[model samples]
Target: MQTMKLTIAGKGEGDDAPLVEDLIGQLGDFLGLLREVEDAVAEPGEENEIVWRVTGATRNSPLSIEITAFPKRHGMNIDQRERKVRAAAAHGLAEIKRAPARPDWFDDRALTKAGGIFGRVSNGLAATTIDFGNDLPPVVITSETARAAAANIVRIQKPVDRPYRELGSVEGYFEGFERDGFGRLVLRLRARLTNETAKCILQGQAAAAFEERSVGEVIERGRRLVVSGTLHHRGPGRLYQVDADRLQLLRNSGLPDVADITDPGFTGGLRSEDFLAGMRDAGSA
Candidate 1:
């Protein structure tokens, strides 16, 4: 088991409720995909490097969160428990909402150091979808740098093998992506590969390891580079691919909501009874 500790350096608002709720939710995630919890967001000091800790086991792939925030202002104080969990959710337990249209989504928008670090290192999260027309925009499946949606992020070099292993990666076309009724990222990716492009255009719909995984191969092109790809989706670790011919990015709408996949009781100001009641109301109303 690896004990992850972080010293969150920045201007903290020092709020504990959000922090605590975020933490409990993360711990539940560590326990299992099906585990559910409510309210873990924390409130630490405003503008201080808070020391955070999370005890996790490799077997369960989970951990407990802890933090100590120092007030940036004199006499400023915080609930230590709150500080810890907030740091965890913002940093560790929580997943980055990769708004690709924004360059800083991966860097600047990370709520905390732990979130950014984990987003960079954790496995899965190769690709997230963008729905241009469909109600479901797209959710970021993975954000790990090691395992990117497309193996070669930026297509720079010519192929050295029979079929190009990877083609150029596309991102940053919009200021921000939108989400629709189904909670999916709504966007489309179009690329003109240089001459004979990579044989495969790998796709990662979101961060679940190998979830929605596939490769697209370019067969024809004009003076403009040829483009080809596929839509991949996974369930229960099983693989499925949508045929490129019928697969249209335009069918989807906005982005996926973390709340949908996250534990219903998971915190975000949505209380247990209220959350359930809201869902019920949403269904009927």
Candidate 2:
């Protein structure tokens, strides 16, 4: 387990101290942002369940609230996991300081959520700081940071219609499937090489073909599929959707035990060196 602390300070004290309700609400938003960051940084099936506790509070001139985070999980490489959580926390907070411009490491969903949280948390606080200890610089959140984050959220939420372009054929493992708001079946595919995910919409014949297959079995077995379609994009590196005209299941193939093509008889009785030499001679001629 690893721990990190957050300190929220207000501008005044006594009757002038930040209201309890406001502090509580802001703290909730702060925690929500942290969770968003955690999800953004965590790889599939490797997220740590974090438990938070409010360690103490002070009624001094500048009211302060201290909260600690304890991340729990079971596995070997415990140190590496802890370091991942800590690094994620640091990176998330650092990005908060540069809001209104989304970071490449963070996805659109996380950025939108974090922006909303930052706007709320900075509403009535003097400052907020996250302490990771170990002589690392803390992350500070201020009202200005909140303003920028809010602006970025607004930009992302703005409506814009985009056209889809031909994406041809793409191969990937089937992650799962879902129905969109318009009741269209959407297939979630993770690319074979990059592991990046893409949403493929089944239409017309493609939809009918998918319905004929054992959808549940395919998903359960982690089957690979090839989708030939047109694609839509929100921005660079962000693939919004694919309108698939063709969908086919891909079969797994294993390496052959022997190189049959390398045999002379298989190559028209020509040796490998002779074949290469003939090709070189032809090219030079």
TM-score of each: 0.19, 0.55
The reply for model 2, stretches above 4 Å from the true place, is 1-3, 13-16, 40-48, 55-78, 96-113, 134-137, 159-173, 177-186, 190-197, 201-218, 221-231, 236-238, 242-285
Residue 111 of model 2, lDDT score = 60
TM-score computed on alpha carbons, candidate 2:
0.55
Residue-by-residue lDDT tens digits, candidate 1, 50-141: 33333322221122133223343456444443334333333222233322111112221222332323333333222222111122222233
Best by TM-score: 2
lDDT measured at residue 162 in model 1 versus the true structure, 0 to 100: 31
* lDDT of candidate model 1 versus the reference: 0.28
Model 2 poorest ten-residue lDDT run = 252-261
lDDT of each: 0.28, 0.63
RMSD vs true structure, all candidates: 21.6, 7.8
After TM-score superposition, the amount by which residue 258's alpha carbon in candidate 1 deviates from its true location, in angstroms, is 40
